[model samples]
Target: MEPATPLMNDETETLSRMTPVEAFLATPASNVRSETPQDPEHQYLWRCFPDHVWSQRVRDTSSWVWDFGYDIQNLNGSRRWVCKRCIQNKSPRPRSFAEKGIQNANAHLFKGHGIWAPAEATKSAAQRKAEKMKTKDQRSIADVMKLDTRLPREQEIANSLVKSFDRKHFQRLLLEWIIEENHSFSICEQGRLRQIFEYLNPLVKITDASITRKTIRHRILSAYESHKGKVIAALKQSSGLIHVSFDGWKSGNRHSLYGIACFFRDENSQPRKLVLGVPELRTRHFGHNIAAEILDVLDAYGIQDRIGYFTLDNTESNNKAMEVIGGELGFVGSTRRGRCFGHTLNLSAKALLFGHNVEAFEEQRSDQLTYLLRSIQRSEFEMSSDPRIKARKPLDLIIDNDTRWLSQLYMIRRALTLRPFVEQLVLKHRQQWEQDNRSRRTGNLRKSAKEPQICLEENQLTTNDWDVLDHLARLLGFYEDAVKTLEGDGQQRRRKRGWVGSYGNVWEVIQGFEFLLEVLEDYKKLASEIPDAEHFRININLGWEKLNKYYSRLDETPIYYTALALHPAFRWGYFENEWKDNAEWVTKAKQMVREVWEREYRHLQIVRNSVADEPVAKRQRKYYNPFQAYCERTRTVSGCIVVGGWGQ
Candidate 1:
C-alpha cells in the first residue's frame, strides 16, 4: 500500500473536523533538508523517522503522529500531551509527568525508533517495525551534536549488570591501586564511598556482597595461585639454570622477613625475575631455621632442584645458612653458593672507613670541644644568645651510624663541608678563654673535675689530619662507583654491562676482583703525594688481602668459568687471556671447566658410561675434548648465536 499522503495547510485548518488517525495519515512527509546538516539541538521532531526517510517527512508530522496514540491539548496556546492509551500498549502508565517540551525529546525519539522499549511494554511486530524506522530518523538529527548523552546512560546500565560482574577485573584494579598508592583496607570501610558509588551508579551495588577488603584479598590470592602455576610451567619449559637471591631485614616489630627472589631465562629466551616469597620468621634466627624457611618456599614451588646459584650477602649468618642448605640439598660443590660481589665490596670499604678506631677519635674531639665551649661560657664570654652563632652553618658533624650502609661516606663528606664552622667555634672558645681568665683575680671561679678543660692543641685538626679525611673521601669514591655498577638494575646493565650490574655471572666477579687489586697497587705509588698516606696505604693493603681470599675461592667453583666459556664468542679464549700471566692457574681453570662438564652434563654422563668398557686412555682423550664437541653440537642443534661478547 502507498504511504499516507501529507496533510496540506487546508487539512491542518480542518484538523478539528477529523479523527486523530485521519489527521496523521494525511500529514505530509518533511521537505526538511538541513540548510546546514541538521542541528541536533533543534531536530527534536525529526527523530521519529529513519535516516532513509527523515528528510522526506514534514517537521510537523511528529505532532500529528503523537496525537494518534496520545491526547494532546492546547494549554494557553502551548501543547500539553499525555499518553492516555499507554496501558493498552502494555507499557507502564507512569504517574510521572513527561514535559511536552524538548527536555525529554531524545527519549521520546528513542522510543519512537523501537530501538528501546520501556521495561513494562510489549508491542506488535508492525508497531516495532514502525518504531525502528522512526528511531533511525532521530539518530540522523543527533549525529551533529557535540555530545550524545544517551550513549553513556545506556552503557552505564549495561555495565552495572549484576550477573556481568567480573571478579578478575576487580582484582586487577585492586592490585593496581595497592601497588600505585599503597592504599589500606580502610578505603573500603568509608561510608561516603558507598554514597559516592550510589550517586555515580545506583545499579552497581557496593555492599559487602560485591566489594570488601577480604574479598579483594581473596581475589588477589586466587590470582597469585594462577600466576604460580604459569611460572612453574615456564620454569619447567626453559632449559636455562635458575638463580636464587636472598635479601633479609628485620621489621620494626623485631620480626625477621626474608625476601627470596629468583631469576631465569624463559623458553623464548627472555630474562625474567620473579619474587617467590617473603615469609616472616617467627623461630629463633639460627642457621637451620633460616635454611628450613628457604627450603620450604623452594619445595612448595617445586623449584628446589632447579637452583643453579644461591646469591647472598657475605655474613657469618649467611655462611652458616649456606652450609645448612648445602648439607640438606647436596649443594656441596663451591659453585652452588654464590657470594654477592656487591656485598664484598661494601665490606672492604667499611673496613677502611670504620676499622681504624675512627669512632674513638670522633668521640674524643666532640668531648674536648664541648668542655672548652662550656668553660669559655662560664668565664663570662657568653655568646650562646648571639645571632651569628645561632645562624645556620653547613650541617654539623653527622656521626656515622654503623648499621647504615655508606654512613662513613656521608659522615666524611659532611665533616669536610663544616670544617670552617668547626674551626671558628674552636677559635672563639680559645681566644675568649684567654681574655676572660686574664682579668680574673688571684682566686679563680672553681669548676668541677667533670668539667675540666683540655688544651686546644690536643683537640685541634691539623693540616695533616684534614689531608687524611680528604684522601679517605677520594678512596671511598672508587668503591662507591663499584657498588653502584655491581648493584644497578638489569635495564641499565643491558645498555652498558660493565658500568651496570655486571656481576650477574662468575667471570665478571673474578674480573672485578683482579681490577681492584691492580688499582690498589697503583694507588700505593700515588698515596705518597698526600700527607699521612701510611694510614690509607695500610687500609688498601688490607682490602687487597681480603679480596684475594675470595678470589681464590672462585677456583673451586667451575660454573663461574663455565658461564663465561659457554658464550660462543668467548669460549675458552677469554679465560686464556685473563690468566695468561699465571700459567699454572690458567691450566687449572681449563681442567676445572672440563671437570664441571663431566659432572653436570646428563648426556655427557650417559655417553661416558656407555664408553666405560673401552680402553682407559682412549676414554680420557674423548673426555678431554668434550667441551669443544659439546659447543659445536649445541650450535648446530639450537642455532643459538652469541648476541654479544662476554660483558667487560
Candidate 2:
C-alpha cells in the first residue's frame, strides 16, 4: 500500500527551497568521529554501503532530525542527505537520499517510519512516481535525452552516445557494442541491427554495406582514432612512472590478442590501471616477437619513456621478452621484471596435482574422465543404485584451461565429489569383464570374440590417487586466503582509468615467496618420513622445487627488495633479522637496496614542516597531563631499538 502524500507546511517548504550546500553548511558537526574513530556502532555500514561516504555533520539543525539522518559527500563533490535510522534498522538500500535538499528525506522518514519532522509539504514516493510518469508520457525519447540530465561532468557522454538521428554516431556506437559484446563485426552491417536503428529513428538510415575483412579494418581504425587521443593524454599526465602488464588472450573466435595494460598514479596522485590495447598478434608467440608487439603498443600510447616495472606470469618466454624490452627501453630487463605472484602460486599447485610432467598428467586425467563418464551413462550400465533414475542424465565434466589454475583445482575437486558413482561404474565394468572371460573359458561365451572388453585399469582412478588429490586440495586451500588478500578488488577504478589503488604490491612478493618456501620445505620433509605417503613425496618435492626456483629468481630484480625496504612495517631491519642465520644473505640484500636507491631514487627530495610537528598526545583538551602526569612512573633505562620484527 502507498502512503499518502505529506502536506508541505511553511517550515518544510523553506527547507526544500534551501540549496543542498546551504543546508549542509547549516548542519552541525558530529563529535562521534573524533572521539571514536572506529565508529563501532556503524562499522558494518561500511560493508553494506561501500558506495556511501559517512559524513560528520548531522542534518536538520533546527529539530531532533539530527538523530535520524546524515550528510555525506557524493561522487560529484556535493552533500547528500541519507536517513540514519532507516539504515540502522538494517535496510539494505533505503530510498532516503535527498539530492537537491533535505525535503525528500524528511518526507520519507514521516511517510515510511512515522518519525516527526518538518515534512508537511514533502511528497511521497508514489506522488513522485506519478509526476515522473506524466512527464515521461508527454516527452519523446529524443526530447528526454536532450534534457540536461547529466551527472557532474558526466552527462554529456550520455547525450553524445546518440545524436537522436545522427547516422555516424549510431554506426560508431553499433560497432563498439558489437565488439565489446563479442559479437562479430558482420552484425553491424546486418539487417537486424539496421532494422532496430530504423525503428528508433526513421530519419536515420544505416549503411547497408556488407561487413567484410576490409570493412572490419576500416571500422576498427575509426574506433581507435576516436579513443586513442584520450589514452595518450592520460599517459602523458600520469604523475608516476607507467608500469606495464601484458599477457596473451584467445578470444571466442580463436583469434590471438595481446592484452596490454598500464599501471601508475594519475595527475591527481591516484592509482591508474588502464588497458592500452588488445590488438591481434599475427606473428609467432616468441619472446622477441612478443617484445616487438608490446613495444608497438607502448609507442602508440607514447609511454615508452615512462615505462616502469613489468608484472607477468611465470612464462619463460616472458623473461626473454622482458630482457629485450628492457634493453630497448634502457634498463636491465631482469631487474625491471617482476613475476605475477598469483600465477606462480597457481603453477606450484599444478605441480602438486600433476606429477613432474604436468601437461601429460593433465591430458590423461581429462581423457580418462570422459571415458569413465561415458561408460557409466551407457545403456549397459547404471550410474546409480536406483536404475529408474535413467543412465542418460546429463553430466558435465569441466576441463581446465591454460590461463586459469583455479579451474584446474575446481576440476579436481569436482572429480573427487563424484568418486562414488565413478567407483561403482568402474567396479561394474570390471565384474562384467571377468564374468565374460569366465564364460569363454568354460565354452559358454556370452558374446562373440570380436567384442572388446570395457574395463581398463589405466582409465580408473586408484584409491591412492584419490588420497593424493584430497591431500593436495587441503594443502592448497591455505593459499586461497593469500591470493584473495593480494587480489585487491579495485577493478572499477582501473576501468575508469582515472585512479587505481587497492591492488597487490611488489613489496609483499618476496616475503610471500619466502613464507611459501618454508611451508613447502617443511611439508616435504615431514611427509617423506610417513611410510604410507611415498607417492605423496614425489609430487610434493616437484611442487617445492618449482616454487623454490621462482623464489630464487626474485633475486634478479631489486625492485622487490626496494619495495620491501620502502615499507615502514618491514624495512631493512626485516631483512637483517629474517636472514640472521645467513650473514652474507643480509649483506647482499643491503647492497641491492643501495643500488636501487642510487640508480632511481637517490636525487628525490621532499620539503617538510619540521617546526610544526609535535609529539603525539591526547586528542581532546578535556584529558589531563597525558604523559606529564605519568612522568613519575617512568625512569631512564637503556634499551635496544626494536623495529621490523627485530630487537637486540
Candidate 3:
C-alpha cells in the first residue's frame, strides 16, 4: 500500500490573500494521525516549528532535527534536514533542505505548491488527472517554457545550439558524427536514437527532415563540395611551397581508395597539413590515370608549379606517375620523385631479411608451429579435468608479411620468448609420434587414433637456430626505431619534415647508409667468430649488396651532400674526419657541392672591395655569406702571409 501523507493539511486560502510560504507552513496534520505520536520528538517539524521553541542552540537541536529524532546526537555536524515523512518511510531519494538553511525550504514550498498547498488552494483531483493525461507534445511545450530557467552559461549555450541548427551546421555536425563514430546513415531513422534525444532534451524536437538517411546523404554531398571549394581557395592563396603525398589501398569492402594529403608552412611559418581528398578509384588504376587524377587536383588548386615534393613509396606505378608528371613540370633527373624514407628503410630491411622469397621463411615455420599447437591442445584436453592441472594455452605464432618487416621483427621477438616452450613441445610431439607407431604395430589403438601425426621436420627450429634468431632480432631493433622516427605516425608530416631530426631526410640517409654498412661489416666479423659457423650459415652479404646499391644512387643525388655541407655542424671538416680512406670521393663530394653554388646560386652574390676603411679583423665581413665565401678564392700578396681567413 502507498504510504500515508503524514503532514497533509486541510486549510484553504486564496493566492491573493496568502503566499505559497504562508499556506505551506500553516498546513495541518493528517486526518488519520498516529495517536501514539504525542512526544516532542514525534511532533517536531523543523521546517514548520521554530528552532528556539524546540531546544537550545547549545544542545544542537538542528543536528537532532536533521536525524529525524532527537534521541541520538551526531558527533559529526549535519547540514540538510530530511523530511519527517520521507525519513520514516526510508525513501531512497528523500526530500531534504539545502545546506544554506531556509532558502531550499522556500524553493520547495514554491515548486511543490501543486501537491503541498492546502486542500482548497491546491489543484482539484480532476485537474491533476488531466495533467497526467497530457500528450508528449503538450509536455514538450511545457518543458520549452523552462529553457531559460537554467544556469547562465548552460542556458546561453543551449539557446545558441538551438538557434544555429540551420542546414549547413546540421550537415557538418552529421557528417563528422557519422565519420568519427563510424555510424551508418540509417542511424538517423532508428527509434532508439530519437527516443534518447527526446529523453535528453524534451524541448528540442528532432524532425524527420533533420534525420532522414536520404536527406543526410544529400547534405554530406553538398558539405563536401563546399569544403573542397574552401580548400582550393586556401591553396591558391598560399605563397609557400606545398608538398603532397598519395597512396592507394584497398579497404575492407574491397573499394580501392587513393588518399592525397598536402603539407606546407603558413604565412606565419606555422606548419599546416590538410587532406586534399580520398577519391575512390572506380576505373583501372593505371599509371597515366593516377597521374591525371593527381594533376587534376593540383591544377584545381593552381599549386602545380609550387609543388615542393612528391612523397610516394618506391613502386613502379608511382615511378611512372612521377615520370609522366615530371615531363610536364620541367623537373628532370633522378630527384623528380622524393622517395619516402620510411618506405626505403622498409624495402632495405625486407631485402636484408628475406632476399628473393616473396614471404619470409619464418612464416612457414609459424604455420607449422600453429598446427602442432592445435594438435597438442586436443591431446592435452582429457588430462585437464583436474583443477590443479592448469590447461596450457596454445602458442600464438606471428605471421611474417612481406610488406611490413616490423611484423617480422615482432615475430622473431615472440619466437625468442617461446624458444624454451617450443623446444619442449617439439620433443613431446616426436615422442608421441614414436609411441603412436608402436601402438599401431601392436594393433591396440582405435581407428580414429590412426590420424596422421604432425611431422616435426617442417619445424626447423633448434637450440643452435635460437642464437641466429636472437642476433636477427637484436639487429632489426635498430631499423624498427629508424622506421618509427622517420615515418612518425604519418599524420604530422609537416613537423616531421625537419632536416636534422630523426625524420629521415635525404642528407641523413647518406650518413645512415655509411653507418649501416659499418654495422653490417661488424656483424659479418662477429658471425665468423661464432663456433660452428658452418652449421648456421647466416649470410648477411646480400643485405650489404642491397644497401650499397642505394648508397651508390645517393652519389647521383647532389642535394644529399649539399645539405650535409650546408649544415654548420658537419662541414667539409666533418667529411675529412669521417671519410679519411676515401679522399677522392670526399674531393668529388666537395666539388659537386661547389658546382651547386656556381650553377644555380651565383646570381645571388654581391662583390665588395675589402681595402676601404675597415681594419684587418673587421674586413672579413666583406664575404660573410658562407656560400659565397666558401666558393670564391682570395688572391693574397706573395710576400705577405694570408693574414685573414679564406674569405679575406
* Best of the candidates, lDDT: 2
lDDT by residue for model 1 over 161-202, one digit each (tens)?
Answer: 544545346435645676478576547646797567445533
| Candidate no. 1 TM-score | 0.53
Give the RMSD in angstroms, all C-alphas superposed, for model 2: 23.8
lDDT for position 243 in model 3: 80
Q: Which candidate is the best by TM-score?
A: 2
- Estimated TM-score for each candidate: 0.53, 0.59, 0.57
Worst 10 residues of 1 by lDDT: 49-58
At residue 8, give the lDDT of candidate 2. Answer: 41
Query: Which pairs in model 3 have colliding backbones?
Result: none
Which has the better lDDT: candidate 1, or candidate 3? Answer: 3
What is the C-alpha lDDT profile of model 3 across 617-637, one tens digit per residue? 422334323222322222222
Q: Please give, for residues 516-545, the per-residue lDDT of candidate 2 as tens digits.
A: 666667778777655578768877888888
Full-model lDDT for every candidate: 0.56, 0.63, 0.57
